[model samples]
Target: MLRRIEMRFLRPYLQEELKSVKMKSQIKFQIGKSGVTEGVIQSLNNAFRTRKTVRISLLQSSGRDRTKMKEIANELGDKLAGNFKHTIVGFTIIMKKTGARKPENKR
Candidate 1:
C-alpha cells in the first residue's frame, strides 16, 4: 500500500526505512520540547489532528520516567481509535506497524 507518514517535531535529518510500514496512514510523534514525558504526551494528544497511527520518539533525559514510554503506549493504544504501535530503543519509543518475525535459527 502507498503510505503517507507525517513526522512531527523530529530533527529534519533522521532517515527511516519505509520497507517495514504496512499502513497507508502513519505519523511519527517527535518530542520537540525539553521537558517531562507527560508534556510530550500531552503535546501529542493535542497535536494529533487525525486518527492515524502515531509513532512517538522520546528525547533522552536524566531521571526520566522509564515506565512513561510504556504508559504512553498503553494509553495511546487504549484511548486512540486507530492502531497504536510502540517500539522502544534505549529511552525513545517510535511507533510503527506491529510486525513480529522470529530470528531464523542458524546452525
Candidate 2:
C-alpha cells in the first residue's frame, strides 16, 4: 500500500523531468580562431532570439585549452549580458537563454 502511494506521487514528477529533457532543443555553433568575434556574438544573439538553448563546439585547430574554453564561456556570458548563460558539457559549451535581464548601463 505504501509502495503504491509513493509511486503514484512520484510518477508525475518523473514524467515532468523526462518532458523537460525532451524539450531541450540545442543549436550548434563552431568557434574558430577569430575567437568569439563580433560576428560570432551576433550570430549567437540571433540564435537566442529564436531558440532557448545553444551548443558551442570548440575546434582542435584553434589551439585552446580546456580551462581557456571555460573562460571563453564566461566571457561570452558577460558579452551577451542579457538572458544568456553558459555551461561546458564534455568538449562542447552549452548556452541557455532565460528570462531577460536588465541591460547594464554602458555610460
Candidate 3:
C-alpha cells in the first residue's frame, strides 16, 4: 500500500522531467565572399530548430564592405530569428584570433 502511494506521488514529477527541453548552441562560419549572406541566413533557418546563439566569423577579403556586413548582421537578428533574441559580434577585417597571432618582437 505504501509503495503504491509513493509511485503515484512520483508520477507527476517524472512526467514533467520527461518533457523538459534544452536549447542548442549554434556556430556558423562565413569566409569573406560576395552574395553569401542571404544564403547563409536561409540555411541557418532551415537548420536551427531550437533556440541558439550563433557565432559568425567573417574571414578576410580584398573587397569587404562594412555596409553589407552590417546589413547581414541586422537581417540575421531581425529576420532569421526575429522571434528569438540573438547577439552579433563583428571583427575588423583581417583580424586573427589572439592565440593565433604572432608574438611581438622585443626591440
Q: Give the best candidate by TM-score.
A: 2
Residues 1-107, candidate 3, lDDT per residue (tens digit)? 53344335545764343224111233445646563467776766665554233445566672446666566555555656435432223342111111235699999
Candidate 1 per-residue lDDT over residues 1-107, each given as its tens digit: 11123343233442253223323435655553443356655655554544333556565543346677666567655654345566454455555434346799999
lDDT (Cα, tens digit) per residue for candidate 2, span 33-80: 778788888988888888777878888865568788878898889888
Compared with the true structure, all predictions reach lDDT values of: 0.50, 0.71, 0.45
By lDDT, rank the candidates, best first.
2, 1, 3
TM-score, prediction 1: 0.39
Off by over 4 Å in 2: 1-26, 100-107
Q: Candidates sorted by TM-score, descending order? A: 2, 3, 1
